[model samples]
Target: MDEAIIAKGLYKRYKRVQALRGVTFKVPRGRVFGLLGPNGAGKSTTIKILVGLIKPDKGEALIFGKRAGSTGAKSLLGYAPERFSIGNNWRLIDFLVYVGRLHGLSERLAAERALYLLEWAGLGGYEEEKFGNLSAGMKKRFGLVQALISDPEILILDEPTEHLDAIGRLEVLNRIRELASRGKTILLSTHVLAEADYVVDSFAIMNRGRIIYHGSRLDVQGVVRIVVDKPAEFEKALHRAGLEYSISGNEFIVETSGVEDEKLVLRICLDNNIRVIRYDTSSSISDIFMRIVGAEKR
Candidate 1:
């Protein structure tokens, strides 16, 4: 896949606070890469630099192999900011058309794109509805349509489902996954861990403007745990099989190096006649994310 985005030694500062400190990473073409960070950790700042909305104090950002801010590169991507603020008085369909036209489409083409996106976003009959009258969830759906009207090859979304309810979150996440499966490159920035795990093919964890981890899903598949009673006996069972284990209360975390180790653990437990109260595997993308992203002091 062709490279969709690249950044090197990027830095930004805002009057006493260094928002970004030499951040750098790349997103491959036709994959969803999640940019994850805690609040004020520079997730939004890195996004701003990548989209050319704000200049970086140092280093470079590239989109579609072209430098960010280049006229030739600007049209290849769509952006959805963290906040949703649009013309409240305009009809949903009309607003999308206006956005499309600004991206270089003719009026008729813009209108066509607008209608298509509105319907795709589940706002088919509500196209003629006033934006201000729509509920918060509906407004977000409309905002999504605005971002997608240009049919961009790369999508840069900042907190796309922030502050939404369960249904709304699922709605947006499903749409994001659908877009990626269609071979579009997505650079997703969000503080929501569970949803990002579902949509992203890879991850880049940022902390106060620095890139700490950048890798594929397999990289995060370390040992994870599910707690149950009688962990001591379980620990000894694993020990007999030459597998190491750690413990926290009744919860025992056994490290299964790979698929073979995982199977070995299950077999040993079954053979011991242990009353498998609750057996489960360890290690998940979310576990790795939380551990590294929320590192503590010694």
Candidate 2:
């Protein structure tokens, strides 16, 4: 895949806090990449730099090979932050029309586009509703409509699923995947692991302003259950391998660095005739996130 966005050693600092330090990741064209982390991680800070909302203290960020925040770069991207950043007083359609105009659209065309967006977002019946009166999910759809009004090549989303319930989250996730299928590149920053799991093509897991892991979902192991007749021998092997292994009953908990490590252990066990009774790996996105962020307890 071609690179649509890239960041190298990005650093951002506040008066008393270093929100981002040496953060780096890449987004390939026509794919939805998950920018995942727990609260207080640098997901938001990294996105702000990508969308031109804020500048980085050090290092570099680019959109389509150009410096981030330049008009040429910004024109290629649209963003909807975690917060409802649009005007609350306007009706839903009005807000869409207003944003369309801001993007240099004519009044008549903007109106037509607004109606189309409303229907597309499942809000056609609520066109006259005030933005402030809409439910959180509705507001999110409204925000998404405006971001796409510009018909940008790239989309920057910060916690897009933040205020959504189960159905709402699924809708958003589905929309993101649809966009990716249509060749739109996306930077999806979300705490909702299940949403990311269902939609994202790749992920970068961050923690305390640093990226701890980044790769395809297939590479990470979220859960492991190992069964062996001589548990002590397997436990010793795990220790010698310098892996983070836990225990529950006679079952061993193993988290591989990636598929490569998992293959290594499996090969060794099979060769040694270790009577493995059971072994399983979890693909749960939530479990992956917790382990990556060091938030999992045993």
Strongest candidate by lDDT: 2
Model 2 per-residue lDDT tens digits across residues 114-223: 88878888888888888888899988988888888878899988999887898998887788888888989988998878788888888998888998878877766545
lDDT of 1: 0.82
Q: Which pairs of residues clash in candidate 1, taking residues 3 or more apart in a chain or in different chains? A: 223-283, 224-282, 224-283
Instruction: Give the lDDT of residue 136 in candidate 2.
Output: 90
Candidate 1 residue-wise lDDT, 27-50, digit = tens: 999999999877887999998888
RMSD per model, one decimal: 2.8, 3.2
Task: Output the worst ten-in-a-row residue range by lDDT, candidate 2.
Answer: 289-298
Residue runs of model 2 more than 4 Å from their true location after superposition: 221-223, 228-245, 255-278, 295-298
- Cα-based lDDT at residue 92, candidate 1: 80
